[model samples]
Target: MTDTTAIDIPGYKQGTWVLDPAHSEVGFSVRHMMISKVRGAFGVKSATLVAPENPLETTVTAQVDATSLDTKDEGRDGHLRSADFFDVENHPTIDFVSTGVRIEGGDFLVDGDLTIRGVTKPVTFDFDFGGFGADPWGNYKAGATAKTVINREDFGLTWNAALETGGVLVGKDVTITLDLQGALQA
Candidate 1:
């Protein structure tokens, strides 16, 4: 990516920004056993944001290795990688490609298609701009947050167990959150 510092892109920096994985995180939480929530983070991934000449035409893409899911529990993470869940051997990556972007209520609404387990669905994330600045290392940096919720079943991640408590072991809904930090590249 080329460092773009001469122009300012709407809702982002002037040029392409490469995701700093060490400073960014992709995480999720879902109700478990109908009583509590299970939270986890995918610590491995790659993402990029391209700010076009027309700032409003910006685009973004991301890929998450399904096998990197870490719920902090060895057994559950192993299960999540099996055929009953992500089936990492078959569908190793979950991906997202933005289709459109617009400002709404002072925030950026990014509309995109998210793919998981070979299933794709339209989703929109509320994007929060964290502004652009210079890091201590003298590199220009940009930061933001994206958040959304999706139905696990919609993405073919419907595996679950029934609880005698009248609810399923895992909730259908999953909340995803992304904290993004990027460095301007040239």
Candidate 2:
């Protein structure tokens, strides 16, 4: 549980904040071949934060364009968008809706439901605030980074190939990260 009274955001305000998609990113990294890691990012189709007087009471929702996945390899990217993985044609977007927020020690934990390929699971992202400020045009902005890890199988992403040496083509766990920036709405 979070002691909302203990949470003090310096420049916080109560209002709706819209994501600055141009400055925001939703990325993931997964273990490849039981060795190195492969990283990729998806386009943030939309996101919004409804901040109340108490930041802990804020609610967040975001949609990620799964079809926009890019890993710098065309073939791999195409495969990821196929039914074997994200199934972008059938499940075009990965969505998230916050359920709760809490403070643990010096960090914030955002609890939410993450849906992928029609499978929904609870996840907690360790959130780090990047402070609030104003841009050159005087639009109040806020920046943050949050991350969590999940098992690909849990999301129905069970496709894999076995190597001759006994290892699998892909690892089970995946790390999801969000680099977010939003502007406070008038």
Candidate 3:
């Protein structure tokens, strides 16, 4: 019998990692008036990740400022900050802490606790590993794209209005996207 180990893979090294916000983006989209979708991005302030050689044993934590929400429309953005929505004044930050990571068909399922508006819920995001490489500055960089969907109402953001057309003003489902880049920590 032959024992084989220590094969070098492109990525899968174990170490502490820090998110590079300048290269990362957290975005979301929600149904608007049942006729269109409104998209916005949250400036990911910071994040930390710890991964073993095996991607499955990874832990990730991130924080996003709720007040940094921007939808390209000031009026709508203001509404989202009020009591009817995120209530940025009360909940200044949104947080995520991964509980587990699983890989399926080359994709990853990152399960974590997501807190918004004082409500905490378990959510899972489908993530795609974008591989890893060394940067010009000698920093190892890893990239990933993640996506998930949740009901806004579940987070105590139930403010809504009835439209004359016989539907609610906004839909309940909100889709989120995360474009993340992490730099190897020394």
- Ordered by lDDT, highest first, the candidates read 2, 3, 1
Per-prediction tally of clashes: 4, 0, 0
lDDT of 3 by residue, 1-186 (tens): 222223344676799999999999999998888999999988887899997776666799999988989999999999998888989898988999999876556555889999999999999999877989999999999998999999999999899899999888889999999999999998
Per-residue error at 15 for model 1, in Å? 1.3
Report the C-alpha lDDT of model 1 over 66-107, residue by residue, as the tens digit.
888999999999999999999999999899999988776556
Instruction: Highest TM-score: give the candidate number.
Output: 2
Which model, 1 or 2, shows the larger lDDT?
2
Each prediction's TM-score versus the true structure: 0.91, 0.97, 0.92
lDDT of 2 by residue, 65-151 (tens): 999999999999999999999999999999999998888787788999999999999999999889999999989999999999999
| Candidate number of the best lDDT | 2
Candidate 2's TM-score: 0.97
